[model samples]
Target: MEVTTLTRVYRYDGIDLPVPPHLAGDPSALRAYHATLYPAILNAEAVDLGVSNGALVTEYRRAVGTKGR
Candidate 1:
């Protein structure tokens, strides 16, 4: 069987907060703003959470920067 792994990171206040392995596969990991704690990059204002993908975190910062909130 092929092995697949996903690391969930929460980027909060310029820090990378890694999600515990136990919560890695949580179904509520992704959701719209105010729907869940997990913050999708597109919904930067929705949460103060981080993401595993560095690129996504960059994008989130850019988006937030433009908003200046």
Candidate 2:
């Protein structure tokens, strides 16, 4: 009998995130789906990154205010 080990690392914002086996393979479908729903994806990612929807909206408003200033 023989045994082997495998490891993979994925990072987002300098932090590691887990990848499911299916997504670890081909990501074309995932890419296409994200492209088609980018706005929703952005909101979800913001939430995942610890920023609530209201917080993100506030941040965007602050950015725009700074740009105008």
Candidate maximizing lDDT: 1
TM-score of each: 0.31, 0.30
> Where does candidate 2 stray beyond 4 Å?
1-5, 27-69
Error of 2 at 55 (Å): 35
lDDT of 2 at 29: 43
lDDT of 2 by residue, 45-66 (tens): 3222233333211111111123
Worst lDDT 10-window in candidate 2:
56-65
Top-scoring candidate (TM-score)? 1
lDDT of 1 at 20: 56
In angstroms, how far off is 64's CA in candidate 1?
A: 9.5
| Model 2 CA lDDT for position 21 | 70
